[model samples]
Target chain A: MSTAERTAVTATRTRGLRRILRPRARLWLGTLAAALILFVVAPAALSGYQFGLLAQFLCYAMVAVGIGLAWGQGGMLTLGQGLFFGIGGYAMAMHLQLDDAGPGGVPAFMSLYGSGTVPAWWEPFRDPWITIGTIILLPAALAALLGYAIFARRVRGAYFAILSQALVAAFAILLIGQQASTGGSTGLSNFRGFFGYSLADPLNQRLLFFLAAGTLIGMVLLVRLLMRSRYGELLVATRDQEMRVRFLGYNPALVKTVAFVVSSVFAAVGGALFVPIAGIISPSDVAVVPSIMFVAGVAIGGRATLLGPVLGSLALSWVGAQLQDNYPSVWSYFQGALFVLVLGFLPQGFATLGGVLRRRKGDSR
Target chain B: MTTTRPLALEVTGLRVEFDGFVAVRDVDLTVPAGELRFLIGPNGAGKTTVIDALTGLVRGTGTARFDGHELLGRPVHRLVRAGIGRTFQTASVFEGHTVLQNLDIAAGLHRRPTTLLRRRRGVPEEVLRALDTVGLDDLADRPAGELAHGQKQWLEIGMLLVQDARLLLLDEPVAGMSGEERAATGELLRRISRDRTVVVVEHDMEFLRNYADTVTVMHRGSILAEGGVDEVQSDPRVIEVYLGAPLDAPTATATARATGRETR
Candidate 1:
């Protein structure tokens, strides 16, 4: 063969190989479908309660992906996704409670917190669509306001991190202090039905699981589309060099704010789905500790890679759940050790393992 | 390719001070469209300072108007948008992008908002035309970081070409180029001057003599002389500055004066 022909052959082979191995949307969707069928449908076939728990874990993974986008890709170091998550959970929880209690009827937690009468603020949640809409809009609006204030003033790095953490801290404190309006320390729980269907029924439980799975899959696709767009390049450029991007005729603050708002919306949606599957809404669920745990999973996966966040979140959550069952008290220490190990030895995360192995193979060849 | 237009750039009473020391003091200059002006001076003579002030990189207490728009206090991107493009002393190409991408970005200047809403299109034909001018079209796919020094210099010029600015500010465009590369760059500048105003700051006297339609000499934060290359070269003050001698006499005359004094 001529030199051109040899080059063409190599190009063809590479193209074919890429087609076979590239992580296309269909491939990922198919994989997710298969996993849903196996973990959710199969478990629903065998045991209903176990399926519900797995769905809850999937919700956590969805929030982890949001953390990855904000902290990992955009370099915002957000330790307050839990606040948005909680907003979503509470929005959905309020709506469910209202649906259960009917108009003017007080929820179980409202009487425990001290009021025999339903609050006016909880009245709007009587509309299921309004409550669901708030789940997506409330957190995004808050993020937009917060991100605008912080990024517009050029506050970034550890300062932004601290500010975000403070938001979550304040949120948890407010939830604990507001006993009359909110449930205070003991959250709104013991839900019975969602839109006239029994949440405890096996079919209803499976349906909730499917919804959570579908939401996660949808969020992943949305993020993938965003990352492949021109805005995505600007986002990455903002992370790498803000000044250069500014000189390149882009407003870095605006770009970062949009990404942060989008990430917050993702977290809210995840938290919204989390309520029905987990069957609880509390200050503890949206506290500072859980917020940090969300970031830890993304860091261990790889911030810049797509699948890294999802798999890392799922694996870490699974391990945490397993260890909690096996050792109970010692699991927290082991989790901390895992983070330190990953940070020290594999700072690039497990996603880069394939690249490392490829380099070794090239050297041998 | 030429028009009898007014000045493309005009600077009046340009003053730049850094930390209480005056770097460029009360300098005045102008370059008409389609004219090639050389800013020639010794080290620390504030030539680069004048260019930086013109490009909005340095704050100067003077009026710099580009096509009648005030340039001072405007940000760098705004200046670029106002039809003034510049090449740095050290090339500042985006290293991650391909050669074509760099040119494409330059071509996209002021035309499209660099947002996700804008679609990425095929490399504009003007980009290839620019590469052809710089003779880098063959390497369009290669990363800019991997180019040779001369190639990078040419690539920077190609970027400026695609920007199609009315005024081009170049700092030492041939600083590190080989002799052949220098000659090609001089030719390139002469050709580009057919349609745009070019203000070049260069220390290479030969390159300036070959390409500059007019040369301005700077000394101690001021314009010392302004004329054609031969006129500025033979100016007594320019000679004194270049030779590092006193303002009055040649070395031979000075030596003879000293001997006569010693004999007396």
Candidate 2:
């Protein structure tokens, strides 16, 4: 071969080698940076109030992680994550409420709103262990059952999205109507403690922040594990060509259901943490509007990537908080404009910005 | 060796209906093990539908027993699990995945739930073998969407091969292929069918004449003719209803009716 031909071959090989190596290295680096920032940097820099806000955002970020898996990777397009989040928050919130009320004492809201007695359904959550278990298990069971029914029947795309939205809407309405049992429209709030730690203490507040941070990291690791596994490839295969996967002696329904269950668990855990961080869980929080917001964050962040949902939700939550606190009324308009522009221009989200620019450069050649 | 290998596909009283219209009515067919059987007909001849019925894609009321397992009543995945695998006319593959990943996913019937959660340690022996068989080993890392039309069709075949299916049903495997790709696919088909029973639902008469061990002709749902390639080609019923028409010529009766039948 000529020297130029040899040089060209080496260059091509080098580029191919780099293509294989870069993504894995970048993934590890990005994960480490996220860990350092979340566990160390953020806590040190922000004040307790600001840190609490970040903690709340992390809960949403956790929910977004599942969305990234289900909607982004699995092509589920789950829009009712708020329902699971609400379930988790309510599960945790009820336990705390019971703890606050103490032995045999009904919560103040029940006596004031309706009957002076707790419902039979509210009885199990009095045990903290049961409450925690309920937070995880309920969403898993619900998502599995719901996902199987929908997927097995081959109801997908817009129909699935609409069904999810309707379910969340119904959940919100059910909570609101159950005034005596579920604290009515105000929902559950004013927690004195989490597990045993006093909520008012600054140290414990920081501990809660750490818990949120640790849990978010754990969830990311869990997602990374799923995305790398053989099931991950199957999930993507099911997403892109479901019937093809079905014809390969694998049930697409089962694969889809697994992702949905995991997504719900993530949202539920985030919601459970939100109870302590935000100090409230209401019907408005778990309704159609908030459910759509979770999807919006995933869409803006780039659902397909692991960190996209986490970073996207954090950005949206932070920006929304700033606007709500300062601009108030105009925040929605500005947020709407931003949403329209991002989806219009970068439909894959900000995660694909690097790729988009590189593509445009290639176009010039 | 011929007696040692069992029968692959046996159908009796197979009938399929959509609404009130019958697509395939009372068709019975069988192929001995390891036979490269071809099902050829003009459009709406129910050639693809017969494969679809056997594979459990469409709800067909009949008994299709493959490798001693009943196929007709089971779901698509269950039939696949029962050692039956099929491909589509418009090559179905995971567009985003690499060729290796596509094969790896297909070669996952025996993968336990626990092992599924871990990343692939290295290339599996079966996936590599399939890649070599499909002539896609060099392009293993390339995204399936980036492959040529012939390559995509080959990849689809490779997927079924990795699946280790006993009964392989291929629908129009070489549609729109250049002469070179067509010849290569015919050779590949012959290689893959040495042990496994392969049923090719094809249109290209040239391909069937060259490679098919046996041919089953369908016209208007039921079987028109069935025999060895040269024998079936000369059959008057097959020529009158099917082979006599220009290969690309769409019949008025077929075109005006059943446009939606091909999609499912």
Candidate 3:
């Protein structure tokens, strides 16, 4: 054969061979690559400060996963994920502060800022097991109740978004108003340890980062299963044709409630982890702004895709940090411009890049 | 088309009102098992309201029984579980999903919650069979939104087929169809009614004359007449209501009244 023809024949053979791996195999391979970067490359490459910042972004990414499910798939448009995040964050923070206080003593901030006596509500969090359990269950229960109420009334779209935003605002203001129990506006912070591990130790900090990374990956896998499962189809179906789904013998409200609760639980778990990693739990984190930021991250990532929220969160955070360091005065405007560009030009976000490239190629041909 | 053991539906004193204005008033309807019944009426006739009551989409005062289960006062999904289903004027398929996925979701009425979590296994025989029944097997993998108008309607009927919905209430299934599409839809409905009971709310007079086994004419939210095609068509009252002409007056005078002036 001529050399050009021979090379073309070999290329065709290799392409056919590679197609044998299939989508399922490709997914597993992609996941392995991500895990390697997160667990090994990230730790080996970055300074401790930058590494900690990445860990913080992962927590936000976790929140984005739940937002993707509830808002992206279920069409909920929840603007108050920070409320659930705060619930979990405060739950963990209370326990950490109580543990540091030793036995029945009050946290230093509480004694300094408010009444010396610990409130009755703060007592249950003193037990680490109860704290952990509450961290998981409280947000889910609240979400279930709140989701049922709103969805049952068929309140959605901008109204649901507005209500969720109002809720986070109220929650933040409530924390600020309560001086004695919640440390007023300053909120909860300065944990000496995490479940008996010294935060001062570099080894423990790395371990916490790993925990956050593993949790984020686990959540992505879980939501993957949900999206592939019948429940996932039903969730998307519910989003599109809620009334029709009702006539299909599925309770649309119940279907929606499950998505809402699951998403809220994810946010809560992210919040719970945030306490140990970021060493703070304040109203500032749980207010309306951070919750909206969670949404922006997911939207920029391609909300419906499995890993879009994670990648989106990481990318947005990295860029935001770089801009803040360099531009300082106009960093916020750059971020706003980024949101407009992504949401306007690429409504489905970065996940559609492959499809766009393929389409362009097809058009050329 | 696969044959299903259709359920019978009976309603008595079924009344529906929107804020003190009665849309459907004390109406009585009985559709026997495996009968293809057509409900025809004018603009304000409330033929669709009766369906709304039956499907639990609206609150009605009286009882609507499907087979042995009570339909009224129950949630819509519960009524669906009780073997009742309906299609809408506007297409309601999950437009993003493939044709096969749409049917699979409908056929999964009996699936357990835990089973819903796992990825769907191999396609069930029922789903594959429904695909062929609706003649959408070729487009099984195509997104539902991509289907043409008639094809979308057929896919909807296919969904009800696998849902195993015994009593099917179709609203304007051929609203925007060409003659050819109408004939195909008519043929499909005929095949469906061989086993399953069907109530179709329609406005196309030609489609009705061709396909209706029994027709119930409704006027002003009440049953005006009920019988075979020719019987209702010949009734003077029916002709008068449809043409808006006075039966007792002379033809010339009736024409004059139409223009609001005396012809004589």
Candidate 4:
């Protein structure tokens, strides 16, 4: 064989070796191991109520992970993810309502407040399969459309943030206005079962929590795989130097849209699961303030690190619950203070704490 | 020194307006493939503006044809896919990525159906060749943000190469470089131009005279002179544009010295 051919073979082999040796590969393995421990091993020790709380927290962490990808990595600050979250939650809630009603019967709420007629739009969700499909598709479709229009028009940065927040506000107002069909400000709740699994049973509740945990882990794994791909690098490139990415023959709009839509899907899935696990879906749960809180959790944890958003969201929610229990009025002040402190000092998030400590150790040596 | 190579870029009557102010006015230029052309002019003479217009970074009226295809309303990325590549005046690159990663991203430009889901092949042979061409193979793992200014410039050029760009539009590629860095860049530019058309917007007259096969001088948003470097240098209009006031022997030499690295 020619020397050139030999060199090419060597180059490809070395690249393969390099791919394995990269720090990201190690991190991926570590995350997988940790996920197993958290999802499979740790659940055995927790009480049913604690496990349910954990599942709900994981759902929030799921949304936070999406925030990290788009806001931290892709440089898209999606402040109104609650809109997609609401969409997913409502989709799930509507299906649950239909299932409990059992063929041609109006949901209990419709008889109570809504006119005794099921809305035409809610008809297709009667089938459990469509409900499951809509849980994934509805938010993805909306996000794709919104992302395409906004990104192609180059609406980004603070303007994009305001627009997204405005969308959430408008969505909440619309839900309120459609009180009869939507359950109004009260929102949809009182789900009886999930695909025939009785919610009243503690064992069934545990099963739901397991499903949420398993789905969250799967989503994280999917994100990890994507971040290692060529498209991941392009996403980061688009974030850092969009004009240069354009000159390199890439459509920045398409790349950003993909990231935004993926983020929306994650939020949608989180919201869908939250409905069953939390036993409710209300307008208040998906308002603009909740959307901002979602971003807050991501920012506090570390938007760029894979584990940061998950851990940060879990920690923030847990602490917020504790604070609300102990001193409800001061909880908001504490949350605001924490956000300010983190943004001011650890702008990269708490994930960088390890790196900072390591650097300091190196400096001393 | 002219060969029968086809024209890679043809622009005529191009004008760029920003609000009410015209940045580039009624410009006409053509570059044959496999040629190294220098665009030199005074500050704000619309050298970069013309490059922007051609690459579709700025909206302009007129005709720009690349390889027999009209290129007027196309987006920047489409122009890049159509074989027109560009580098910025300030050496724009993915600063967060490593040298190898930068090249890898550039090589993935032609990947289809979007970059999501499909994992692009890792560091193609072309990227390796580009890294070697720019003499940055050894520093492949180093973050690009930490590279020296000249190294960043070379990396950006390597990016264009890996994109298989047929027409390279470089704006002030060697600006702010040390003497040694400038010499190396000039050599690199000359070597890369052997297989593609390269248009460099520069301010250094001596470098143009030394390396440019053809030089086009812009004055007040229009082409003032175009020819072999020596011919354009000797042209009265070109000399007058350079000196601005009038062409006395001392003033001309002073202007040349002020532009830096004057050859004669």
Candidate 5:
């Protein structure tokens, strides 16, 4: 055949295949199927301890998705999501402790701190529904307010990043100082039940694992949907060129603020789930170190690509857990080395591998 | 064709300083509705500074009234909302979006409601009409960054057209166009100026000669001459400051002899 005829045939076949496959739908379906299998089927096969670890990793992955949206896409470089995460975790932790203590009983931490009475601020957390709802909404509302104050004045880039980091530092310090109610450096732990269900029971543990897995899948789908919408286009535009987006009549500050808040809420939900699965809440989990770990996973996964952050976080957390268990002395250094290697060699993250393969295929065709 | 209404843009004693260096100094100008005016000068003559000040991109101490609203301290987006649209010297089309999406964003500003539940109509027919006017309707689906230089320039103009601003500020609208593209741009401007006011900053003399009803000349951050194109071209101060000293002896004589004509 002539070159023209061959080209025409190739084009026809490509179009026919595109029509039959519907690339976007296929991707969605494939992702959903994979997540279902990973959450439902894989956990069933693993030991109880392994399932619990997966549950913890899923929570971390949820936070990673939020970081991907805020720092990766919106270019906010937020290093303080841990503050919001801790807020949700502590809120839920307080409620869980109260439920374990029974009516009119003080938490064990309050007794150790000095006062035999629960603080007035901790009163609202007694309601399970309120605590659960606050875990989702409180951090988002606070983020919205903070984002509006900073971004509206056009504070961005490194200055915004430093400000967010400072907030996290202050939060950790505050938690450390509050020995009575907050559990200080050690943090609140040794919970017995959540909403009247015994935490020690194997069934409750499995249920919490499923909840975390379901929550992770749901959060990923929500982000995917948002990123595919027109608002997502506006968000990317705002990130690329705020001046141009402004000239196009969009208030870039407002758009960025909304995205930041939504991301914060996602992180908060992850943190809330994290406490129940891990059976503990501590300053170590919501400190600057963990915040950096959150960003490292996103960078290693490819910040712009969907599913990269989730998978990257899961893989990195799994490795971290394993190395710490097997070689406790060098695990931290090893994780740091991994970040350095990824940054030095694969700055676009592992997602670019797929793009390269596709390009090669196109060239051959 | 003068109306009782004042000009769309009236600037008097406009002065803009950047770190104590005056970019636009004591310049006065006016552009009437339905008229195409050009501000022409050599490089560093403050043409773009004037555009920036008018668009509120730069702060200026001047009396700039557009449809009777003060523009000196207002923000750029607010200026656009007040019926003043502008295109940048370097084309400002969104690189990641399609040409149609860029225009839709420009037009979408006027269509936003108080709530998010409202359905936003995609690229109205008027936007398509604007693209057709600039001969870029077929390239609507293409990413804007992939378009040719001249086509991107036209697309920027199309964005301004779809904005439907009462007063349009176009900075170097035909800066990188070919001969055909430049002529097409001139035609497009002429067609657009029938229902709106236009203030264009251009360095292309031929383009100014073809389209400008009035030409404002600037030198050293101030208006040196304002009149018809021929009047500004013949102004001695403008020629001396902008066109440079007359080519003496060998150069002039050589050009005259080559063309078989007397030196001016």
Candidate 6:
């Protein structure tokens, strides 16, 4: 074939490929396009401070995605996700604090508040890799253990909710009590660097924002894949009728445990990233209020849909930040009213709001 | 179908007590493979409890075995994996799923190590076949929650059919079915009995009379009589318990006639 003819054939082939990328492929492509705009384009457009705020919202969005999976799909009502998130944040914060401290040195907080010596528990976190590993494993292990014990005994519904909330309360108390190791109620902050990238640099901060956005996109994609699988069907089935699932030869407890563990790991990863992005880890962050706020964001977004929780959380948190800045006194009240309105009117969340409107229109017709 | 067939389910001295109120008491029952046996009694007679004990849905102090496997202490899932499938008194289905998806979940139940990442797109032939059997193949894409009560019952039974369960314990399978649906269900149960052990706990006397090969009558949590449907109906003790009159009373024949004409 001649060069001109070959070039024409190649162009047609590319056009064919583009045409084939319709519907499902188009959905993924759209998501990718949106992600690029958000993580890359938006970062480029926004100031450093605005980008950092966006990154912080992304961290909460990460937690909301996990809540959507567990509470929305699995029917777990996991109000204590902050427990996992806080644990992950603390793990990362401790490692950064240790890194800021020179070798053969304890974290500055330990010297100031604690005895001059480093606690035995804090020693392992000095290794950045260990800290990262702990952030993933610890919360996952706790969720798995708790899920097994509760689900095996068939403790569910409101009881399970209460038990998980109690665990968060207890975790917050434990962290607060361990002043020397945990830096007490004020939590850990004032990080000098992240993996040797200086936090003092605006470029590095922007990079951190990109990293968070990238992780959120990856986690959302992973959850989307899971929701389309047989396991996802089984999880929903278990939620609807556990005894029926057992009669079909599935251990519902095991299915629920898997969902709980996956959600916890997501929260943990979110928490770990939160440390560098938010630059703080404290008892107040991991308490019941934050845990419930995580649920509220999911509820506002629509619990069952893939992107609802992420978008809902980001929007709510951003609005909250704005509210705090402009109307600090009434912002919380506004937040409560918005949540109430969403619950009363759009129980399926904003994700299904379009469907609800369409249905009402259809009824009129 | 034959006396020579090995027993598929065997129970001895089976008893279930809930908070010291004896629900099932010292029941001794044996069912051979490939037989359609019906357990019938009035309300609160522990007919369902015996099934609960056999399927490990409720703890019972007795020996219950299915195909030589001890089932008394085993969990519900193990019993299911060992080829015992049960339907609830109130039809319990994955209501949010389409008819095909419900069957798919059932058909895929025995698959080992359900993968975490892969999407399950294909429906198993067994699920398709079961849907066809229950005549729900035409409506396979409709959500089960939207199905009529009778259809939901059929879907659940179809779920058991997809599992290829060796032993089926159906609790009130025709509770809310219309007469036509009940007749179809009777035909389906007869078909299922051709190659499997079926123990149906029902209050529908006419259905048992038309379809059951053997009938076990329960009264006050124990077997009152056990035999062919005609024999159990004629058994003097069964007549008294069912008719609320002595077997030799003047009202006995009238009561028998009334019961014979009753459908449910």
lDDT of 1 at A35: 69
Q: Which residue pairs clash in candidate 4?
A: none
Question: Which segments of model 3 are wrong by more than 4 Å?
Answer: A1-20, A360-365, B1-5, B244-264
Q: List ranges where model 6 is wrong by over 4 Å.
A: A1-23, B1-7, B244-264
Ranking by lDDT: 2, 3, 6, 4, 5, 1
Q: Which segments of model 5 are wrong by more than 4 Å?
A: A1-20, A360-365, B1-7, B113-123, B245-264
Cα lDDT tens digits, model 3, B1-264, are: 245466778888988989999898878888888788999887778998888888988899888888889888998888888778899988889999999889888877877778888888889888898888889999999999999999999999998888888899999899999999999999999988888889999887778889999898887878888888767766666666777433223532443354444223
Q: What tens-digit string does per-residue lDDT give for candidate 6 at A135-205?
A: 99898898899899999999998888899999999999999999888988999999989999999888888
Q: Report the error of model 3 at residue B71, Å.
A: 1.8
> What's chain A's TM-score in each predicted model?
0.90, 0.93, 0.93, 0.90, 0.91, 0.92
**DockQ score for model 3:** 0.77
Off by over 4 Å in 4: A1-36, A40-42, A361-365, B1-6, B113-122, B244-251, B254-264
* DockQ of each candidate, alpha-carbon based: 0.29, 0.75, 0.77, 0.58, 0.38, 0.66
| lDDT by residue (tens digit), candidate 1, A1-365 | 98545655665565577677765755666667856775556564745555666787789888887877776677788888999999998898888887888777788777866757778788889998899789988888998998988997789999998889999999999999987777888877788898788987877887787777777877777777777665665566578656545445445688789889988988888888888778888999999998988888888888777767877887888789879999999999999999998878668676665555455556777
Native contacts kept, each candidate: 0.26, 0.94, 0.85, 0.83, 0.30, 0.85
Tens digits of per-residue lDDT, candidate 4, A248-325, equal: 888899999888999999999899999989999999989999999999999999998777888899899989988988
DockQ order, best first, reads: 3, 2, 6, 4, 5, 1
* Clashing residue pairs for model 2: none
Best by lDDT: 2
**Shift of residue B127 alpha carbon in model 1, Å:** 3.5
> TM-score of model 6 relative to the true fold?
0.93
Q: Model 5 residue A252 lDDT? A: 82
Model 5: how far is B146 from its true place, Å? 1.1
lDDT of 5 by residue, B1-264 (tens): 112232478899999999989898888888878889998776788999998888878899979998888888888778877777788888878888888877776776766534222323466876878889889989989999999888988888787777767788889989888999899889988988877888898877778888898988887799889998767665666655653423223432343344444224
Question: Interface Cα RMSD for candidate 5?
Answer: 2.9
